[model samples]
Target: MQVVPARRGRAVRLARGQAIRIVNTHGSQVVDTWAFNADDPSEFMSMEHLHASLGSVFPKTGDALYTNRRRPILTLEEDTSPGRHDTVIAACDVHRYRSLGCTEYHDNCTDNLHAALAMIGFPRTETPSPLNLWMNIPVGPDGQITWGEPLSKPGDHVLLRAMIDCVVVMSTCPQDMIPINGANCLPVEVHYEVTG
Candidate 1:
């Protein structure tokens, strides 16, 4: 078990059949997560493939997260804060902050993801869309998405079991411009567990 500080990142390697539990320690915080084949970083989790295969926009227990090659990377085993995650949003980055009227440097999820990957010696590359855990962005009748306060509370967690050996990166989202993190960003914790 490891506690990932607010607006920071962490990386972990999971062997096949291992599992990771992501905790919203402070509640209402968003954690952006990415996964890739441990031996081949180029084959990363794919939001498109996952949605296509599951035929749903939100993740649920029993759903298998797919990789770029349409192979199962991880399976959703438990979701204490169920149905409150996002699979359609990309991680926040510098360009997004700039466009949002920020001129100075701001901590963003993209950099966090890259830093986490670098920690594990993975080369920098284009990041795939993240599986936003504990985020709340609902689509309205007009097909417009609006950010809302996360439904997750303190100590709430979701566990994902790895279907294949993989590298997982996580970013405690630092977006202070929206209500995604209840109007303030904070840290979270992660627990890596291996089962027989």
Candidate 2:
């Protein structure tokens, strides 16, 4: 809760022993996140190990998150307001724009993710599965899924602590077709704190 304010078009970096909390201040903001080691760029985050650590799902508060080498990377230390954080959600990409009914969404979240990855010296991969922090996409009994109303109210946040010297970059999603981006498409604030 140190509240280091981050803005749009700029990326924030955090070191080991530091815990950061990001807020979806308005409502159901969608955040696409990635974690990597400051020591090595190749030491990336792996969803496979992440699934193994928390059973194929995204972590809530107190869940441990794993790295590509199966090492402890982050722990979901806090969730002030609960929402459906999507681990299985696909990142928006050009292919998604083409196939998922709109090419206009090209310069969206997936592109931002790729930009962030490339800024960190990683080759941008295609459509990485995302961890939708505050967005709500409900799955029905028939396995059909749809975006839901705003689950995170203003001042609601999720906190994460780095186990290693990890760099996290996020894109506050700007999709308008769904309720995934809080139904308003606003900005979010990310803060860092060294809490060893």
Candidate 3:
């Protein structure tokens, strides 16, 4: 188990069949997460393929995260939260912060992902859309999405099993401009375990 400090990121290598559990150590925090094939970093987790294969934008237990090539990379094995996660939202970037009226440089998830990957010698590139764990983006009756508070409390977690050997990157989301994370950003914990 490792703790990823607030507004920071962590990278972990998971062998095939291993599991990574992300814990919301503080309630209402969102974790921006993505994964890449260990052998080929260019082939990263694809939200489009996952939604197409699962027929739902939100993942649940038994659902597999698909790659850009539509191959399984990880499987959603367990969730202790309210099961409201977002796949349509892109990771927060500097531009996004500026758009939100911030004139100064702000820590963003995109950069966090890149920084974490760089530690392991992975090339930096534009990241793919991430799986936002513990985030709440609710669709209204009219189909418009709005940000909401995370349903996960402290100690709540979601476990994902790697279907193939992969490198997972997670950003303790720093979007303080919005209500996501209860209007304040906080750290999360990552636990890597092998389940036989």
For model 1, residues 69-99, the per-residue Cα lDDT tens digits are 9999999898887568998899999999999
- Model 2's lDDT to the true fold? 0.66
The residue-by-residue lDDT of candidate 3 on 33-140, one tens digit each, is: 899999988888999999999998889987889999999999999998889999999999999999999999999999999999988887776689999998899987
Model 1 alpha-carbon miss at residue 89, Å: 1.1
Q: Candidate 2's error at 19, in angstroms?
A: 1.5
Task: State residue 96's C-alpha deviation in candidate 2, in Å.
Answer: 1.7
- Please, what is the TM-score per model? 0.94, 0.79, 0.93
In model 1, which regions exceed 4 Å deviation? Answer: 185-196
Model 1, 30: alpha-carbon shift in Å? 0.5
RMSD of 3: 1.8
Q: Name every residue pair that clashes in candidate 3.
A: none
lDDT of each: 0.85, 0.66, 0.86
User: Which has the better lDDT: candidate 1, or candidate 2?
Assistant: 1
Highest lDDT: which candidate?
3
Q: State candidate 2's TM-score.
A: 0.79
